[model samples]
Target: MENARSGNAGKHKTRASIVEVAARLLHEQGTAAVTTRAVAQAAGMQAPTIYRFFEDKDALLDAVAQHVFTTYVAGKRLVEDSDDPVADLRAGWDAHIGFGLANAALFGLLTDPNRGTRSPAAAAGLEILRARVRRIAAIGRLRVTERRAVELIHAAGTGAVLTLLSSPPQDRDLGLADAMYEAVMRQILTDAPALPADGTTAATVAFRAIAPKLPMLTDAERTLLSEWLNRAGDDPASFDASHRRG
Candidate 1:
């Protein structure tokens, strides 16, 4: 048992070392420089040794991308939530834009449709955005459903990054990201948190956020409330028409 444990630990260490080395090559020299031979040479290992841990070059690149992105996501998660959830959301957006600009090569890999569609790291990032949007919804400030808010933010961020990256650094508009963020905010957020004391849309969005957690209700009641709130949140007109006859 001791020997088996030691062997597994050794394998983990070797794999991590290889991944770190590949990640460095990918960063310092871009994706094309991360071939198995280059990574093995950098790690001071035999090329065949890489095959023991990774199936192929693509597999190694995937692991490297995961490693690099996991570090970034961890940093994003470490930020403490402030009193203003809207501010927190804006901070997260800024952090994402900064990361994309700093890690251009990794960003390309992450945005590749072929790989991104199945990337756990990409999914993790999206989940973080959802959490941020959920907080805004809970505060009665979101004008849209949580899903729509997330999609709009994600699309805006991607477009902002790609547009900035396409330009020369000196020629790039420094205000583009902030402008895009403001545009998304205008589309998704209300005037202020709970400002209109009698606003239906804000209250409906807030209620939808907390409906499931209302302990006074049974599971069936909660489910029904959720469905109604979903309708109300997604389309207020449909919600009104559906209940008008009743």
Candidate 2:
């Protein structure tokens, strides 16, 4: 029993080590740079050993998503004490941006269309994200629909961060960037006709507006949503359409 436990521990450690090294390579050099042969070399393991842990490139990329969501986005929380819906929204916004900036590579993989919907790891990661959105909605502060509010708030904030990351040197200013973020957020919270606050708490108001329309998704639909959410990192069009049409 002791030997068996020791062997399992060693296998776990090796798998973890591969994931760490692969994540670094993907983040630093992008997914294309993280070939099985290259990752094996970097991990100081043979190619076949790497294959033992992951079925294929997609599987490894899914593991990369796992690392990003688990290590970074998973622990994110906002507005722990604030009852103000606006304040809670802002806190959630900031946390979302911070996570993207901190984990650009994993963010990239999560967004890649080619990554597809094969890996269980990616599916699990999306479930974690969905729970976080639910929590943010439960904060009882915002007047917009809970899921839509969560989606819009995140799209605006993280969209801005993506812009900054992709910006040219001459166009980047952190202070001005933050100001722009604040302005966009205010408009999103107050200006949208679809998400008006009519004498109710922001969260409740928002939830009510969107509750009837929230997609009655099958399990496959949920998986598709995960893929779409990640893809929205590059283009918000599909995600926007889904929310509006749903």
Candidate 3:
């Protein structure tokens, strides 16, 4: 048992070492420089040894992405949440942009169409975003359902990063991200009015936040109510007409 435990630990260390070496190479030299031979040489291991841990270059890149993402998320977790949810959300947006800009290669690998959502790190980041959006809804400030708000914010943030990354650093518009955030905020949040102009929408948003917790309803019933609430939030008049018909 002791020998087997030692072997497992050694294997884990070797895998981590290879991933760390590949991550550094990807950061400094971009994805094209992360060949198995290059990573093995950097880690002081044979090329075949890398294959023992990773099946192919794609797998190695995935490991590198996971390593970079874990490091980034660890830093984010150390930062305490702000009392003001909106402020917290803004901080998250800035952090995300900084992470993407600083780790361009890893960001590119994580955002690749084939590998993007499949990354556990990417899913963790989305969960963080969702939590932030939920905080806003809990405060009765969100004008849309929590899910919709999360989607809008995620789409805007991803688009902003890709847009800025596409431009040369010297020519990139630093303000674009802030502007996009503001645009999404306008679309998804209520103003400082005592009551939103669209009361049904605000009610829908608020109710959708707690819809899942209603013990009176089954899962399917809650789902149907959530769908109705979403439709109401989007178009109260249409939702009302549909209900009247029903």
Query: In order, what lDDT does every prediction score?
Result: 0.87, 0.61, 0.86
- What would the per-residue lDDT of candidate 1 be over residues 1-246, giving only the tens digit for each residue? 999999999999999999999988888889999999999999999999999999998899889889999888888888889988999999999998998898888888888887777888889889898888888889889888888899999999988998998998899896999999999899989887755455456678888887777889999888888887888877877877877865
Candidate maximizing TM-score: 1
lDDT of 2 by residue, 191-230 (tens): 3322323433453443433444567967776667555544
TM-score of each: 0.94, 0.63, 0.88
Q: Model 3: per-residue lDDT, tens digit, 1-246?
A: 999999999999999999999989998999999999999999998999999999999999988888889778778778888899889999999999988888888888887878887888788888888888877886678877777889999889888998999998999998999999999999988874216455677766777776777899988888889778878878988888888998
Candidate 1: list runs displaced more than 4 Å: 194-199
TM-score of 1: 0.94
Q: Every model's Cα RMSD, please?
A: 1.6, 9.6, 2.5
Q: Name the regions of candidate 2 deviating beyond 4 angstroms.
A: 77-85, 113-141, 168-170, 175-180, 187-246
Task: Give the range where candidate 2 is weakest over 10 consecutive residues by summed lDDT.
Answer: 191-200
How much is 151 displaced in model 3, in angstroms?
2.0
